[model samples]
Target: MTRISTSIIYLILFFINVRFVKNQQTTNFSCEPRPTQADTTDKLQRLRAHLVNNNLFAYVIFSEDEHGSEYVQLYDERRAWISGFLGSAGT
Candidate 1:
């Protein structure tokens, strides 16, 4: 009886682990389209030069304004200016 219960418990745990892993893999899948070379080539070159001049390895651009507002004005669209992605998500 003890061995039977242990085996059942192990089987339940194994299925739960498999289910969790599958759920994680599904959540990791992205449908967003990747930026092509035509979309970012020239812009990235200018950005890279600016980074090198400032001795910085990377820079993060946000779509928010001074008030933390996602709906920003044309002047505050820094991320769009660089990446040409005017989506709601910020970089």
Candidate 2:
């Protein structure tokens, strides 16, 4: 093959290899053990009790990402600490 054509082929192959490697570097997720329903309920109840003790009518919980981005990451889920809701925006 011509040198130019060989170089182009090598360039394409290089990019494909780089992309494959990059994809491999992405985060891997596996099924992880989670809190039971009773445990979650107890946590919420305790939070309510704390609020009542403080005479607060209501309270809000917010979670922040490691980067403090407007969008919270799954690992940084604040409300999930108690409410179990995975939404980005919630009370």
Candidate 3:
């Protein structure tokens, strides 16, 4: 498929995934950084528990970059991956 069509398809799937995640997860997906921080922290706590079970003390988290790039690459879609925010401006 062409680039535009591919992007459109991805967008459609993104919305569907967002809906499913929002319903399944207690935290609502948001672009607001502060709100998402709490959500991420909660998730991290659960992850930390898993890590502790495996005898780990810490883990690294790489958040999405917010440079002035015109478009966000599929692989660098950390914001979408974490909080389900479709907008690139979201951190």
Displacement of the residue 65 alpha carbon in candidate 1, Å: 0.9
Q: Give one digit per residue, the lDDT tens place, for model 3 in 1-91.
A: 8846765666666656654643454444565566534345555557646755796533422333367366657887665554455653422
Regions more than 4 Å wrong, model 1: 1-40
Off by over 4 Å in 3: 27-91
What are the lDDT figures for the candidates, one per model? 0.61, 0.59, 0.53
The sequence of per-residue lDDT tens digits that candidate 1 reaches over residues 53-86 is 7865445455577787746899988777777787
Q: Please name the candidate that would achieve the greatest lDDT relative to the true structure.
A: 1
lDDT of 2 by residue, 51-71 (tens): 557965445454565575877
Please give the TM-score that candidate 3 achieves against the real structure.
Answer: 0.30
Q: Considering lDDT, which of the candidate structures 1 and 2 is the better prediction for this target?
A: 1
Between candidates 1 and 2, the one scoring higher on TM-score is 1
Question: How badly does each model clash, as a count of residue pairs?
Answer: 0, 0, 0
